[model samples]
Target: MTDKQVLPKVTKITAQKRQGRYNVFLDDHYAFPISEDVMIKFRIFKGMEIDDQLQAKILAADDVSKAYTRALAFLSGHLRTEKEIKQKLQENEIPETTIEATLKKLRGLNLVNDLQYAGSYVRTMARTSDKGPIVIRRNLRAKGVLENDIDEGLREYPEEQQVENGVEIAEKLSHRYRRDPVSKMKQKVRQGLMTKGFSGDVITQILAKTHFEMNPELEDEKLQNEFTKVWHRNRRYPFMQRKLRTKRTLYSKGFQSDDINRLLDQQVDSQ
Candidate 1:
């Protein structure tokens, strides 16, 4: 009769000093350490036969268990997109296979949902931030969300809220650029709102409602201040050159050509 070889058996399972780790002894020799969750998941027990193939499978399971635990910690603070989580897991040197497995499990649990993430992000930014729908869309794209999901999320940001946000931003900008010429101020406010991601129609609406018109006395004061600055800035030039430079600069500053010429004539007459 041929003698059969006995498999290496788990002689004992001892708790490690760590909160949720254990050491497994095979045939009275220390074989490996594993997480408690992994131990429970694989039904690891003393007297369990651990052949080479079973050991490999058990270790693989532990790797995924560890990766899953880490992923959960990453999600403890805030909701994350798949790309963001993958990048983080890669940074931690988790294997691509293990990362994918962890992601699949998380997705199954609905913990890493792009659609939900996008909608929540849009609603938050629309309500709490100055970000417009376009800006939020761009942000979601950078986070690797799909277009359909982004569209679904943007539904939370209604046009009414957009217009209200636009009004607030435009009014703030109008005040910030109040010293600018009415035309210049309007131009600045328009460009500012556009850069802030306000739609063209919304910006137009904001401009129509916002009071950019200042008193004539205030306008004259602003023109005088600008003219004084321009005049002094060109003082080193000849009289003709100085007047020409001031007129050109003031005209470019959104002052009327006629007003600029009148100011130049006044300066010349005064000199």
Candidate 2:
């Protein structure tokens, strides 16, 4: 009887390079194409090829690339803090090792910065309206900003400077409201400034300093000046009725109650 020969089944496929490196594969899946020199250095057999080991290394590199691409796509849509980006990657079930590798690449590119992002966010919100430090701090904290960074950003503007900004707004608005009773006009201006994100204390201080009192002797001259400003605003008011509506308009602007009544009474008294 002839002796039967037993041969091991080769399941893994490894690529061998004549000059550079060989391509490795597993069950029709390409793993990695390792260099010939690297293979020789590791004593990976030149003639005796192993598929199992080659498959493992290739799979690891594939996983890392996949995780990195996912993170890159997310950052393209919106700016994300490092913590936020990491959390998102992890939620997707990406390996921790992959996450670290991806974040390192992102950092090298300068694509993510928590500090700079927080500063721009604060400035934008501040411009929209005068949100106090309390609201601003809460917002930055929620975004994963460090406490020290928040402190530095907020400290850029002192309390006095913020109040001064409010005063400027009040002054510009006050010009249109001169016809309203001084007391009432001041109240309206205060409300306008407050709604604009000016602090209450700042609004009070501005009103106290710039009194918006009514002076009847100067009414005609003030009315002409006020009318010219309103007209220049690009509104075409019939000369007669325009004056009446302007009075009402001023009242709605936060003019004091007494100012409205006095102005109406005076207009009638004159007619």
What TM-score, computed on C-alpha atoms, does each candidate reach?
Answer: 0.91, 0.46
> Which residue pairs collide in model 1, if any?
none
Clashes counted in candidate 2 amount to 8
Residue range 52-123, candidate 1, lDDT tens digits: 998888888888878888889999989999999999999999999999999999999998999999989998
- Model 2 earns a TM-score of 0.46
The Cα error of candidate 1 at residue 128, in Å, is 1.7
Q: Each prediction's Cα lDDT score? A: 0.88, 0.64
Worst lDDT 10-window in candidate 1: 262-271
Candidate 2 on 1-271: residue-level lDDT in tens?
Answer: 9886432222444656454446654335554566544455455433344455554664555565566667878878677777888899999988888788777877888877777767766676666655656667777788788988888777655677666656666777778776664555677787777665556776677776664545775654554455456534534655456556766665554444464455445443223
Candidate 2: residue 74 lDDT (0-100): 86
Report the C-alpha displacement of residue 265, candidate 1, in angstroms: 4.1
